[model samples]
Target: MSQDEPKAKETKRLVVIGGRGDRAAGTVWLVGAGPGDPELLTVKALKVLQTADVVVHDGLVSDEILDLAPSRARRISVAKRKSRHSYAQDDINRMLVAFAHDGLTVVRLKGGDPFIFGRGGEELEACREAGVACKVVPGVTSALAAAAGAGAPLTHRGSAQAVTFVTGHASTGQVPDLDWDSLAKANQTVVIYMGVSTAAGISARLIDAGRAASTPALIVENASRADERRIVTTLSGLPEAAAEVAGPALLIVGEAMALAQAGTAELVSHVEARGRERGAKS
Candidate 1:
C-alpha cells in the first residue's frame, strides 16, 4: 500500500485526511478552540471536534467547547502557566504521534489561533518528522476579541495604518527583547499578549523610544469571557492600568484606542477579584 493512502473506517464520522507520503496510520489535527466563548468557535472546528477520538487541548480552552467532543473521546489537558507546565512540549508532541500511530484521530486543541504564539508550529514540525498526517483549523485569536470587546479598532484609517502583535515575555519568562524604535512608530497599533507582568518595562521602553506618554491604551483581561474586564488609560499610565488585571490579558496601545470604553475599570476590577477568589473552574 502507498504510504500516503488512508485506510478507511466505517464509522458514521467522516475522517478527512491529507495525503503525505511516509505517514502514520492515524491523523492529527491542530484545531483552534478560539478565545473563551464557545460561540466564537468556527464551524469547521466544531466538525473536527465531533470526530476526535483523542483530544489534547490547552488548559484555557473553555469547558463548553470540550463538551462538544464525542462522549467517548479521551481528553488530555496540557495547560501551561507561568513556570508551570502540565506537560512539556516534547511530551505533548510524543503523545500526539503515539495516538496517531494507534490509528486514532487526534485533535491538538489550542485556546487561540494555534499559529499565534500557541506553539502550533512546533507541534506541526513534530508531526511531520513522525510522518503523521496533520492538518490545521485556525481560530479567532484573543487580540481580535480583546479589541472587539472594548469597542476599539486595532487599525483605523484615520489613526492607525498598521497593527503589530508581540509577546511581552520571552520563552525564558524574562522580558522579551523587542525593537522599541519600530514599535514606537506613530499611528500603528501595538498589541501585547501576556504583557501584564512586563507592563512596566514595556511602557518605559516605548516612552523612551518617542512614543507619546499620552497615547491612548486599552487593557482587556479574560477577554470575551463572562468575567472579562477592560481598562482604558494613557501610555503614561499603562503600567498602573495593568496592575489591576489578574487574568490572561492583552494590552493595546495606539491612537485608535481613544475610542474604547473605560469607565468600568473599578467595577471590572471588583468582578475580577471575585472571580479570583472563587477560582477558575476551567
Candidate 2:
C-alpha cells in the first residue's frame, strides 16, 4: 500500500450489477393539499403528487385532491379524527424515513399550509435528523378559504388591521390557553380552528376580556366545498350557532365579519330555526 493512501480506500472494486443499476437516494416532499378544493392546489404540489411513489395524508385532505396522485402511487391515510389518530406521529415519521431510505419518492401530504397547526414542523424535523432530502410546497390554508367563501376580508381598512389564527382545542383535548385580552382586542380578526366543542368557553373568555357580547361572529363549515355552510351571529351566540354545524369548521370573530356578503340576519334566523328543530327531535 502507498504510504500516503487513505486507510478507508484500501481496495476499490468496481462490480457490475445486472439489469437496473443502483437507484439514487430518495427524497421526501412535505406538500400542502390545500383546503378541500383540488383546484386550490399549487402547481408544485400537483407535480409532486403526480410523480410521488407514495403518499401519506391527513384526514382533512379531500378525496378529490387525493385523486390527483398517479395511479401507480401507494396512498396511505393517517387521518386524525376528534381524539382518534390512525397512526401516531412517531409512526408516521418513521414511515416516511423508511420509504425514503428504500429509494422511493415519499410525499407527506397535509391539509392546508403544513406549518399552520398541521404538525408539518414535527415531520420536517424528523427528516432533518435523519439526513433525508426534504422540500416543502405551500398550499392554500383553510383560513383563507373560510374568508373567501364568506366574502369576508380578514383585515379590513376600517374595521380590522390585524388577523390572528388560534386553535380552540389543545393537544390534551381541553380549551387551549391563549391570551384572551389580546384576542378580544378590537380591530383584529380572530379565526379559531376546531373550536366547535369549545365555543361556549371561548365566547365566555372573550366576553370576560372586555369584548362585546354583540360583536359579529361567523361559523363556517366545510369552507370552499360544495356542502359549505355558514352561520352568522353575535359573539355571545357563538355556541348556539356552532351547534348547527357538525363538519370541519372555523370560527371567525371581529367587526369585519359583519361586512361579509351573506345576509347575517337571515343566516342567524336559519341557524336558530335549525337549532329549534334539533331540540324538538331530542
Per-candidate TM-scores read: 0.85, 0.84
> Best by lDDT, which number?
1
lDDT of 2: 0.83
Q: Which lDDT tens digits does candidate 1 get at residues 23-92?
A: 5498899999999989999999999999998888888998889989988887777789988976678877
Best by TM-score: 1
How many residue-pair clashes does candidate 1 contain? 0
Candidate 1 least-lDDT 10 residues:
1-10
Off by over 4 Å in 1: 1-24, 263-282
Which lDDT tens digits does candidate 2 get at residues 1-282?
A: 102112212211100111122666688999999888888999999988888887888878887888888877777777799888766788778778767776789888999999998888999999899887899999889989888878889999989999999999987887899999999999899999999999999999999999999999999888777777788898999999889888998999999999765433346457779999999999
User: What TM-score quantifies how close candidate 2 is to the native fold?
Assistant: 0.84
